[model samples]
Target: MYILKKNEKFNIDNETITFREIRDKLTEEFTELVKAIVNYSYDKTLKNLKAVVREAFDVIQVCILILRKCHTISKDLDYPD
Candidate 1:
C-alpha cells in the first residue's frame, strides 16, 4: 500500500500469504484504480479528488473482503475475537 514504506515489512501469520504479499496485492489494485481515475481526470479535465475517492473505495473493498474471510474462519472456530 501507499501507506507502507518500500523496505518496511510485517508478518501476517497467514497459512499462505505474508503481509508484504497482501500489501503488494492491495497496492497493485489500488494503483490500477487510481490510474483509472487519473486517466478520467486528465481526459475530462476533472479534479484530483476523483483519485482520492477511488483509492479509498478500493482500500475499503479490499479490507472488507479480507475481514469477512477472517470472520468466517473465526466463527467456524467459535472464537468471538
Candidate 2:
C-alpha cells in the first residue's frame, strides 16, 4: 500500500525486496493470523478478534505488494502478462 511507502520502517522496500523475502514475510504474517484465530476461538474477546483482523490485513497487504513487485520482475523474466 502507499501508506507502507510513507512509513520508512515498513518492510515493503522495492529496492531490496525479493520474491523469497516477501514470501517469507507472508508466511510469518499468516502464522500470526492463525495464532490470533486460535486465541479468539478459546477466549472470544473483542481484543483478540481485533488482532485477527489486523493480522489478516497485514497478510493481504503483503500479498498485494508481492503481486505488484512480481509483475515488474516477471516482465524482466519475459513472462507473459
Candidate 3:
C-alpha cells in the first residue's frame, strides 16, 4: 500500500506497486468512458462504455488474484504456537 501526503504525492518504492496506481488506472478508464459517452452517438457510446467496463473488471480481477496470492504466502510464513 502506498501512502499519499497532503499534497497527493505517493511514496511508492520502485520495485513495488502501490494501491494508488490501481486506483489511478481505474479512474482513467472511467474518465475515458465518460468522455466516450458524452462525445459519441448513443449506440457507439454504449458499446465503448461496455468495453471500458469489461477492461476495468479485468483489472479488478487481476488485483484480487494478486492479493489472494499474497495472502497465501503470508499465511505460509506464519508460525503456529
Q: Which structure among the candidates has the greatest TM-score? A: 2
Candidate 3 global TM-score: 0.44
Instruction: Give the Cα RMSD of candidate 1.
Output: 9.3
Clashes of 1: 0
TM-score of each: 0.46, 0.79, 0.44
Supply every candidate's count of residue pairs whose N, Cα or C atoms clash at under 3 angstroms: 0, 0, 0
Candidate 2: minimum summed lDDT over ten consecutive residues — where?
2-11
Model 3 lDDT per residue over 31-78, tens place: 655666555545566767777666556455445534644654577675
Q: Which residue runs does candidate 2 get wrong by more than 4 Å?
A: 1-12, 77-81
lDDT by residue (1-81, candidate 1, tens digit) is 332223223333334554456677678768877787777767764455666676677667556545654665687685658
- Candidate 1 lDDT trough over 10 residues, lowest sum: 2-11
- Displacement of the residue 61 alpha carbon in candidate 1, Å: 0.8
Best by lDDT: 2
RMSD of 2: 2.4
Off by over 4 Å in 1: 1-24, 30-46
Ranking by lDDT: 2, 1, 3
Give Cα distance to truth, residue 32, candidate 1, Å: 4.8
When summed lDDT is taken over every stretch of 10 residues in candidate 3, the lowest stretch is 1-10
